[model samples]
Target: MGDRPERIADVEGVDLAGKRALVTGSTSGIGRETALALGRLGADVMIHGRDESAGEAVVDELAAMGREATFQRADYASVDDVRALAAAVREWTDDLDVLCNNAGGLFREGKLTDLGVEYTFHVNHLSPYLLTAELLPTLADDARIVTTSSGAHRGVDIEFESIRSVDSYSGFRAYQRSKLANVLFSNELARRLDRTDRSITSNSFHPGAIPGSGFARFLPGPLPRLFAALGRLPMATTVAEGAATAVYLAASPQVEAVSGQYFTDCEPETPSAAARDTTTQRRLWEESATLLGIDEPLADVEA
Candidate 1:
């Protein structure tokens, strides 16, 4: 998850005027680059993070580009903070054209949130689910919803017996579980959207790793710099390059009619065998809804 995946060739001639996009974790690295690109394409962008200073800096960068951009702060690790984010979004606008669940955190040690949930799981997985659910009503017809996932989701499976990882704990393993949850959530979300009146399309992508971001969060000292240098060679792509697929999903015409599938480089790629198991995905989705106290059927909601 520390290296970039293959980049999707950029699409030619696209426009996204009058569109409003909200990208979480957008204050730096790939998220920042993605938001900037979308702004350049004429979308009104909302940048979010826990860091107000960094968020304002990104907003300044976008404004300098002559694009409409604003910053919002919310701690994705806290459910209360997520609720506050939803409230803030409501105050901004009732209609949304796109929502990119790009915010996430990485943890190497065992820590629990105030809610007693695992920190990594709540930040990376639950926060996205809650935010998406909160914003579902605001999405316009044919709107796009993209979630940033990781290639590390390859072999992980949701362990229903221990959703919070109270017993077994490894930073990488927990992250993998959260990512796998994202793909399953995307698929199930598409099904829900299809059953509803709204034509909002939900999809997820493995945005390749950008060297100074999450993966380096716990890298030991100079080791991060060393790996980043090596990654500059044949291994890693720049944040802009890494975010191409996400940008494609957000605005490209290539996937206008495509939804629910896992993507890498703007192409449909088969997910891990575990991810393809519908039964497991459904169970995970149901369990997640229960955990989040979502009683409404996914299909009953208007997109």
Candidate 2:
């Protein structure tokens, strides 16, 4: 979040003119492309990533497109960094029109973060949960919160007791659980927003097996090479294709009033039966609040 010079302040060319958006993990891959598309639509984009150089490059790209852009560096592995990122966003703009939680990964080993939570869960689910909660006040009245969940969540369910524990952990299983959390978080968020009479739209989507990005590189061992090879084939989607659903959710007029649904390929699709359990969704929401020490009320209390 260091000082960076502004490249341009004009928003005369696109449909999102005068809007402000923040896309996390936007230094490369789907996140970077999403930021670029948003900028092209005339939004002032705020890019977030751990790499300063990559973030700066995205900012410059947006600037060159006649859009105002800035960079905020934060590592999701640390809760403190997420908090700092939220604060930085608040200071930058009073109301954010769009927020894309696109930063997530699969860790090879299960390690605890500074918050004593599993690394994969911490980054993919908990970190975004905390950031969104902290920045709630900064969101515009009709702000859209789009999360990049995965189709891998189909067979998984949230194991609340073992979420923070690394005992008997597998990278693939952990990633699946975290992705499920994303869908549940979005569903629960939509419910809470509904109760509060808020206009904010909260939704999640599957970007579809994106092969050439950091996703492939972080995979363990030969899997990375195999995935990279497959990515070069006709079946794998490119970074731009992967970012399509996210960009659509962020800027599309058709979904302007939509909330709390899982989407793929720009269409609303039903999530797994487990992801649709309201009881579990509520339980996860409360547990997450407890884990993060979020005392502020999220919605009106039920009778």
Candidate 3:
């Protein structure tokens, strides 16, 4: 997680001039900064969030920079909403070149969603998984999918039984499980796509602990205030710093050949051993499909 990959300077020269991109959760914090960065590189961007006014503000900013920008409101907590978001994106462009599955959060309440799934897991992992699957046909041939994972995924393993209920749920533990699922889902997606005709690549990354990135607000009690205080420290990771790896993975030429990897600070650091397990990866994919009541994606590609 060190060596920071030169932050925004790493992707400065990449030109994505007619490329179209969708960055979910772009209305604030790391997502907003990532949207702006991609727009600066000349990719017409679709900004996504549940807030219309905030989404429009980002769109306006991108427009000021001479990039085409539009807003779509979708809450990741609902499968219907994710489907609608994918439909809306398809209407905008069939050749989406970059898809950043960045709209995730820490749900401290640890409730169950309508699907009877843990809210944290459903929001952070399953929703992105569904969105990516829905958009597979909509992605361009060589599109890059960048997911926002975290260093917190290191110790835990994915467990469907635990995620289906909230009893014994600890916010941090649920978060760790969900983030781990993000990597597994991302790696599995890359493997499945590799079996197909397209040259798409999928990768996940740790954005570091960014205090002002709006996630801290979900922390219990004075922890949010403490996180804010830490943000003022001399070398605290800025919100822009938190988004740097995502921007790099989305646009940099250096990683165009990389797939199914977990990155930290824009470098391909090996994830936990559990995350690297292919069996777990594929199982998570199949189970996710079953939970959503959909046919297994890329099923004809073979195991």
Best by TM-score: 3
Per-model root-mean-square deviation over C-alphas:
3.5, 5.3, 2.4
C-alpha lDDT values of all predictions: 0.78, 0.86, 0.89
Q: Per-residue CA lDDT of candidate 2, range 1-303, in tens?
A: 011001121222338889999999999888998898888788999999998999999999999999989999999988889999999999989989999998998888889988778899889999999999999999999999999999998898888889779999889899999999999989998888877666999999998887877786776779888887877887777777778788888887778899998998788999999999999888888888788777733845421
Pairs of residues clashing in candidate 3: none
- Number of clashing residue pairs, candidate 2: 0
TM-score of each: 0.91, 0.93, 0.96
Total clashes for model 1: 0
Give the Å error, residue 173, model 1: 0.5
Ten contiguous residues with the weakest lDDT in model 3:
1-10
Q: Predictions ranked by lDDT, top down?
A: 3, 2, 1
Off-target runs (Cα >4 Å) in candidate 3 are 1-9
lDDT of 1 by residue, 1-303 (tens): 232222243543567778889999998767887887787777888999977999999888888977778888899878888888888877777888889988875567767777667777788888888898888877778889998888889887788776655566787888888898888888888877887777788899887666745457565568668756755776566676767788888888878878888888677898888887878877876776677777644745424
Off by over 4 Å in 2: 1-14, 301-303
lDDT score of residue 92 within candidate 1: 77
TM-score of 3: 0.96
